[model samples]
Target chain A: MNIVENFDLYAPRLINKKELLSAGHRACQGCGEVLAVRLMCKALGENTVIASATGCMEIISSMYPTTAWEVPWIHVAFENAAAVAAGVEAGLKGLRKKGKIDDRYIKVVGMAGDGGTMDIGLQALSGAMERGHDMLFVCFDNEAYMNTGIQRSSGTPMGASTTTAPAGKISSGQKTWKKNMAEIMVAHSVPYVATACPSYPLDFIRKVEKAKATKGPSYIHCFSVCPTGWRCGSHLAIAMGRLAVESGVFPLYEVENGKYKVSSEMPKKLKPVKDYFKGQGRFRHLGEAEIQVIQHKVESEYQKILDKVKYLKAWD
Target chain B: MAKRVGMEVAVAVAEAVGQCDIDMAAVYPITPQSHIAEHLSDLVADGKIDAEFVTVESEHSAMSAVIGASGTGARVYTATSSQGLMLMHELLPIASGMRLPIVMGIANRAVSGPLNILNDHSDIMPQRDSGWISLFVENGQEAIDLSIQAFKIAEHKDVLLPVCVNIDGFQLTHMVEPLEFPDQELVNKFLPPRVPYATLHPSKPVTMGAFAMSDYFTEMMKAKDEALKNSKKVIIDIWDEWARMFGRAYKPVETYKAEDAEILMLTMGSMGETAEVAIDALRAKGVSAGLIKLRLWRPFPFEEIRAAAKNAKKLIVTDRAVSFGGPGGPVFSEIKSALYHEAHRPAIYNYIIGLGGRDVTVKDFIGMVEKVIPYNAEKTVDTYEFWGVRE
Candidate 1:
């Protein structure tokens, strides 16, 4: 049976009563970034305003006169979305002081791609977190700068093929490992930090809701599989994302005020990282030796994360 | 009671910030502008000012923290110079676009390549188009006075925009001068409580700085432009009110010895005083040179400039900054544009001088006048030229 024919198997009912990200966006078909955004907006509802950085999501959603965003949305420059959101949040509070606005539960959220989050926007994000603004920051990690034609970004995984990090005679693609942004955010000692992937829609939605409920500086790092950059079949987007988590490549976890909790633990021996890498063309050039090295690294990192959670629990 | 005290312009600016009801100041010290932030930090630490003072890692972070603090409905301030100002260039536009009304002190310094950190207008000249109200203060008194006025003007409902109070690096920012410190109660009366039009509040939430689509993008820019243009009139009214209360007047262009004068010298910031000395010397020689100091840069005093230069036979425009391979300087081009369509316009000449604090002595000013007079006599003055360059 075709995938659409088996809709009951794959199609989850959208529970978000409010539609902040409207349908008919100009995002490319099967764009995982927009899917993540849709899920986040659904979780945030209409009471939130979003400040978006300049990227593929912003370009496609806001096309002059018409916008895919049902909520109040602003697209600032690539690196200053966090700062702009801070200003909006400040402006809101100032207005409230004068009793100009009626009291209502409202949230300010900032959304940006990996290029914006891990690189150019790092300082602004850190400053906002440090200031303890009542805000939520969401980073959609697509591994590469897919909007700018698949250039390499700090978030691009090691040995991954990108336009700038192409596999050739002198080098394996993307020599550097992906930046540990979740850990970096947790180090800021903010109230909350969590990692989620769109492959598990419910889990991603739950994290957004948790971030919204948090009082100050909640960060949600979302892993979004980019079919264009990953060189994977569009149909396998969700499957690849799922495999990444199941193989312990990208663990689902949350850190609350320096306390760690691993939400999904691998019970049996996790699947080899090779199983996850073999499907994507970005990792096609990896030999068996390199694959073994990647697997070892993934397993070791996963253990360290589990140990952190255990340590925090022991102290508590 | 108001009291006269001798203070550096940078110190005056710090004092102004200290006396204001500022809730927070996030700053990273940079050359020529460090004194302002340093003094403010000391004041905060000494309990002279009750404010959250953050010493940030970089200019970018300083601006970011200011944005964050300002979002919390706190009055915010910061300062930077030269390349530090360039690093904050991206944040400047964002601050204004979001209409946060952040009041900043910019010590006008030359931008870097060979890495010179002395005096010039290059640093702020590039930010002229960044949707900020630029106020050029001539001395310590104006620096103190304008810094206080900036907060009031920026936070006005119709003029909700960021303001940059520019003081010449090393010249005005460093030089000590006597200033009349306004009484605290009088200041409190003149500058009412800040009522932020927008802020982050749990109750009655409003969306600001929203993403604009192509459909609404033009309208958004138009709205900002309309606010800035409308602010010009508001600025005039506020300055008038300030004069009424303080007995000291301010205008977009302040004229001195211009009546019945045949030659006019147009300048900004500390160079205005230098030009005044040159004018006085020229007048002593019966040369009929007068001075017009530009107090406002953004919302470019076009009408005031036109009226100021209307009676002059020759207008010599001096800029401490250059516009690269384009015009002689950024201000010169704007002044020329403002006068292009006027009837019976004076012969205008552009000169780039005193870059990187290369001492713009009265002799240099007189030399500029000498070069302009011959060109005016022949009615064949070149539009622009570098004044003191080796070439």
Candidate 2:
């Protein structure tokens, strides 16, 4: 946290030289998930045991006989990253008591994809937070099951064309709205919950440090862009993330204990939602009416967040 | 001084585990196995034993939590039965492959289609090849003895794998019997403090349960297989030590009235006690029948099975769980495979019996032994019939 600086709008944010992920990884070109993870690992330096769920991050980082992770990591089944992480936390607590080992500095982290965290692993994630384990769970939200060939996930945005929910003659794309996983973690009364994007590495790093500082369970939902799945060029990943934030589509915010505050700086007014949607072909099928509907929903959700911040700040 | 007290087997098991000085327990409530979880939580609440008790949401989480805990070099325990055991099917191998040495209690019950929450081996049969040390207990005393012994066996340096103590649901778990409570002093002497070889630590980190590619995957599987196979020696050693200290002898195979018998019957878990009664009745008649009770289910006790069947002309194997569409039962398939290369193997007949808590009387055992005696079991070996099954 002391080392991390504010996001410099005029220039690039300086990333740490100590790379936790190795030089060679199997992630696709312009894979924002790995970039987000690079920043995350920089925040949670050594002395962290990461229990990664089965998904793109796990698959790319750990190909047997080789691994990109320098830190000690484990990949159990898909639905139990948080559960396994909780076990690791409990295990350390027990070992410290019986083995007479000082493990105060050791931290456990759970990492999963949008499919793993929001869908298959939600129950384990919720249970871990409810039990109040000292750990961090970061959901690498690529919005779909990119590893399984662009299948729609619960975190997949509405109107995005996926393998399961294809853009058809009668249908626009995915019919369901994306699940609010950050709010779900917040409802668990978690000590810290935040939403950050890879495009904003400084904000992402600071939040990871905040979660690391929290005494109990903490969660970070990192909005990751996938060029291969989002039907964009490899270089457009960061631009997609920026357009998402600038258009008010994916607002960066944090909920500390109970109080809510938007973490990322917002402009005087938001750019049109069309600027964000037009970059990716997944939303190319959306008509003017569908675009308006999405814009209206995103604006309303953003307003709800603002109203909560205002009311909570009034007490302060 | 240890004293004998009448108590339910499940409670006795939890008490035995509490005496083991375990560090943590993560378990879910499942039918027939609920008593173990309930009593363990009570023990923790009463502060009789100092441990972290977590009531997980599902059996899957229970196993996962135990794996996590065990990976950190903590002595851990958990229990489940039937569907609960079935739910943990995916993580069973991970516990063993990681060499975590977790001790789990399986209150053996039938898996469902008809959905019966009663005594059967279906629960643990599916986990036979999960590279865990499996022991079946016949009664409350065996349950208590084996539950305590499981931790020692699993934590044995040479056998750094998971151990599962299987007691038949409702049959052993629900029954009350007079059992000797080993004071912490005796348990401490017999089962010394566990020394983990490696654990998750911030100081000296180690990667456990790492992914193995094709080049090393086969070797990894082989190593795990070898570990489980070699655990047989450790299991026998712990039983011998327990016998020397407590004066209750335990063996992979226990026999009753097998002296100069031409016909033999094999049973596992709680069914062994019932089959002994059948042997006594058959001896009352001129029929020279004997009984062989298998105590160790995994590692198969091949040498013991061969010796037990050496003198007998026929062996009637009874299984409570079905293999369905292939073999008559899981135990039967293993017996056939174990005795496949015997130079003087006896005729083996498998009887799928007492499924889903259907009561199998002493008369049923006598009848099965007699029915197999009439047939030339040598020709009938490797095949089976469903005993007491409707026409």
Candidate 3:
């Protein structure tokens, strides 16, 4: 007579609850990009079809005869993920119209890197939103073109040392500021647009859930820390991402059809930008003056974001 | 069975679209290709073609809209030229890789730099390797015919790939000719509705264009390769069926008076028709020369080319576009590579001619034939030579 005799020992347990991303993948250890994807898929669940642009996420998950994706997926090209996703959504609608498909709740998601999203894929993404397709576009931002070696992308932050934006005697690395993709999405007047980071998983998950719940087009820009390109330990990916949010370097926020709302609030005594920049090799070459300039820009942008949230809240 | 008269090639293409079973046409107008989109838009407005006509902002959006519309398993069509085609270049491979059977009419024009809007093959040549089944049409009738055939070829399950029907910009797209419009019933039987793989269905969901790690990237490419390679046979079958139904036959390589010919002239697009005039003149001169028109540029008619060049001692391949800094023109290099293993490969010489719509007269063709003489006499040829260039 054992304690097991007092209860049912062989009850079927719900072992695997994770949706979207499946277990096996080729992403490097502690890769933040895949982690963001995992969370996105988890929130999206199984009824979502993904149109992926060629990037690290695509390269790491899909290989010949094998895929880490549990759901149906497509890898179109580097710049047409949004376009392909639109096609999938349209195809889905056409199938529904013909009574060939019954489920109407299926989600169409497009995932691309910053280079794909902000540069090459921008027109397609803009078109999709303008067309008012029922889809979600997710841009996994690693700042630079990490998949093709550390080349500069439109989203690469100023003072970051990428291969294309190498610091030299005559010039500072990535002299331009990151492109405001969230604002660009808002310009489309899409139903939803949000910014999230892996550092704040719950907020990111919530934003995705809200996006899935919304109609028409929605965009989520997720800040994914690239340890390889950033010259940091893989384990520090999450820490770096957290620092980005805590330092207000990358703010957590959402915009609902032009209504802005900051999701995470920073303390008045937040860590300096240098504390965050010093952790990554990309900003290792930044001098005091450059760091000061970056800090000023970040502070100004963060205040603007805060003001927008306040104004929207007051209007609402 | 309805009859309507249209002069411009774009209007004729629009008429064809109206007559066919197309569900949607997404378009953004560019020079030389605008008439087709505009006419299609008019048809959509007039309730002639029951389809969604999306006027996108850019060529990129135009292609993107079509991709979305086609993904929904709808038979889709679009048109673009030169700079527009270049702008949509990034999406061409995606459309093919996703295996969406989208057909586009591309007006071949010279690319920008000099900002010319005239006819040439340079615009479409760069897209030769983008995994699309490229078909070159010489005139208005062929334009109408190929547009219809393009849909059938693209939607074929065995050949589920995108297709680009190349027509010379001002030469064909702006010209008018009598085209025998096919019966609606016949077209319906021929094309039917598109059946796409992995369409977004709510009940049984599927994913397309998924992220492939290195572990499986090669296999995804292999799948596309296999599909494209297999499409050659399906294309031939479709062409045969089309010929049987419409009494107009199309081959990957169409030969004119090639039997027992000693000299063969190869060309593509509208330039091929010009070369035909030269072939007749050369025949009159007792040169025993023939014209071989390359109809399908991709899935390149390697076997057909080899067979056509079998009896020839000298093959003069005239490419309208230059491959710059390379051996010969683009087409010649491809032809040479294909015939490299053949036992009776002929002496092939490449001539770049009629770039930016330079008038290629029968004399130019004769000059090309004359230039091939030294190569045959010496049993050696410069890989390529420019024709009609001042220098």
- Best candidate, lDDT-wise? 2
lDDT of 1 by residue, A31-109 (tens): 7888899989888877787877888888788765567777767665788777656655654554454454566667988
Rank candidates, lDDT, best first: 2, 3, 1
Interface RMSD of 1: 5.0
TM-score of each: 0.86, 0.95, 0.85
- Give every prediction's interface RMSD: 5.0, 1.8, 3.2
Leading candidate by DockQ: 2
Question: What tens-digit string does per-residue lDDT give for candidate 1 at B279-332?
Answer: 899989988888888889988889999999888888888888888788668888
lDDT of 2 at B178: 91
Kindly report the docking quality category of candidate 2: medium
TM-score of 1: 0.86
Encode model 2's per-residue lDDT on A1-316: one tens digit a residue: 3343533442244445677877798889999999999889888887888888888888788777778887778777889999989888887776676655674678899989998999999988998889988899999999999988999999999999999999999988899999999999988988789999989877888889889888989999999999999999999988999899888888888998789988746655888899999989999999999999999999999999889888874223
Please give, for residues A1-316, the per-residue lDDT of candidate 3 as tens digits. Answer: 6634643442112112465566687777778988899889888877887888888998787765557777767776778788777766765664565565574578889989999999988987888789888999999999998888999999999999999999888777898999999999988889899999877777888889999999999999999999999998888998999889888888888888677887854556557899899989988888999999999999999999888977764323
Residue A250, candidate 2: Cα error in Å is 1.2
Give lDDT: candidate 2, residue A199.
91
Each prediction's whole-model lDDT (CA): 0.82, 0.87, 0.82
